[model samples]
Target: MDFLELVKKRRSVRAYQNKSIPDRELSKILEAARLAPSGFNAQAYKIIVIKDEKSREKLGELAKQPYISKAPIILAAVNTKLDDKYSPLDIAIALDHIMLAAAELGIGTVFVGAYHNEEIRDFVGAPNTAEMVALMPLGYPADKEIAKKRKEISELISQEKF
Candidate 1:
């Protein structure tokens, strides 16, 4: 799909079906993330694919989302080399790639940003030196949804300056 169409179609899916994601599909999605533009090519992001139910449950404990464990797959995205430069922006761009790819595969994804840092760090085996920026619960959505309500462009945008 075109970029605009893909962006328009993307939604933060919270409810998911209990289906295993194929390895090839997973790789393809990760490749999409890898191809995202990184600041200065820092390319400091890494993703841990959590297909283990126990680990998912553990993460659910940290995030307090029962569906996280039931989603059949979760991607723990972190910045392995976060520094004074551009790690957060790089990770966010990477996440956009992953989410768009998931949308292409008819998979659902929720951008999970609220969670205990220590728990998330342990769950993904992230180092104390790096920061975890995003978590995504990936699977077949139980029900498709439109995006949450938003302000109009006029309310959100300015001609040149605010």
Candidate 2:
């Protein structure tokens, strides 16, 4: 699909099939994140790929969404540099790239942030200086096309000056 179509097709998939993602596809997704532009090229972030069921269960317990544990894979995006002023922005862009790449590869992903930070930090073995940005559960979607609700252009766009 084209870029626009890919964007439109992307959805926050919460339900997934009981299957594993191939290493090739996962590598491609991570490559997208690695290639994403960062402020000053400081790519101050790291991704912890979670595949162990026990760890996924621990993470799911810390998160509001228990369904996350059902996914075959989970990616924990982390900002590796606490001193980097634009770490959050950098991670956001990287995560966006990952999601878009996954969409193009016919994989499903969802951004999950509501979780116990301390527990996640320990589970991922992140340093005390780093920050846990978000968790993304990935796999093949189990259901049909997901419907989306979007605001009209008029409500979102603005003129040169407010």
Candidate 3:
């Protein structure tokens, strides 16, 4: 439960158990997002929680990630205000908070980025003005451990210059 350990433990969980996440736990995860820092404190985002099986299936099909439908819940992280400069970054930070909270609570999540915009908007009733930043599939993981291969710090960091 150390922060670094929690970061190391987080992974893109593709396989999930067919179990429901308790509402209290889900609320805690959302609270983490709610507390996340946003540019200018303009929390211009909305998380659309999809619990219906049919909706999940449609989203999975639209996103071309069938594994998403298997999740107990799917959250559409959207930029409600659609600010060109800060919307994407703000939404990402919020979802990161959600994911880390889920990891700490033993729930699993995957941040899905690629999807069909028009199809998803129509299916999910997302406003035409809003932007879908990412999709998150949340549930208990079927695979408990994921050995992630990360780049060495030496390969990634720069000392006062790129």
Candidate 4:
């Protein structure tokens, strides 16, 4: 599919099928994140791939989003550079790459931002210096039909200034 079509097809998949993503597909998704650009080329981040059923369940509970547990994998984006202002942005770009790659591979993903950060960090065994920026659940989507909703481009941009 073309890039624009891919972008349009990408959706925040909440309902996932009970199927495992192939290792090669997972690798491609991670590779996309690995190639994401970072400030000063300092890719100070780590992606924790959670596959254990119990861990996924606990993470869902911590995030107060039980649906997250349905996916076969949960990726936690961690910023290793707490003092660097660009750390969060770098992680966000990486996560976006992961999401787009997963969508292209017929895998589904959802960006999860609201969660018990400290607990999640501890659960993932991340050091105190690291901060868990976001969580993403990945799997084959159970619901294929997603309604795309967005504002007009005119409402989102200006000629030269905001």
- Predictions in order: lDDT: 0.83, 0.88, 0.89, 0.92
- Name model 3 segments beyond 4 Å from true: none
The positional error of residue 142 in candidate 2, measured at the CA in angstroms, is: 0.6
Candidate 1 lDDT by residue in tens digits, 1-162: 888898888898888887888988888889999899987897987788888889989888887777788888888888777554687778888888899999898888988884337678866788887777777999888986967888999999999799
Give the per-residue lDDT digits (tens) of candidate 4, residues 40-140: 99999999999999999999999889999999999998888988999899999999999999999999998999433998999899998888899999999
Clashing pairs in 3: none
Tens-digit lDDT track for model 2 on 24-78? 9999999999999998999898899999999998888887678899999999988
lDDT of 1 at 162: 97
Query: Which scores higher on lDDT, 1 or 3?
Result: 3
Clashes of each: 0, 0, 0, 0
Candidate 2, residue 78: CA error in Å?
A: 0.9
Candidate 4 achieves a global lDDT of 0.92
The true-versus-predicted C-alpha distance at residue 46 of model 2, in Å, is 0.7
Per-residue error (Å), model 2, residue 90: 0.9
**Ten contiguous residues minimizing lDDT sum, candidate 2:** 114-123
Instruction: Report the backbone clash tally of model 3.
Output: 0
> How many angstroms is residue 26 displaced in model 3 relative to the true structure, after the best TM-score fit?
0.1
Q: How does each model score on TM-score? A: 0.92, 0.95, 0.95, 0.96
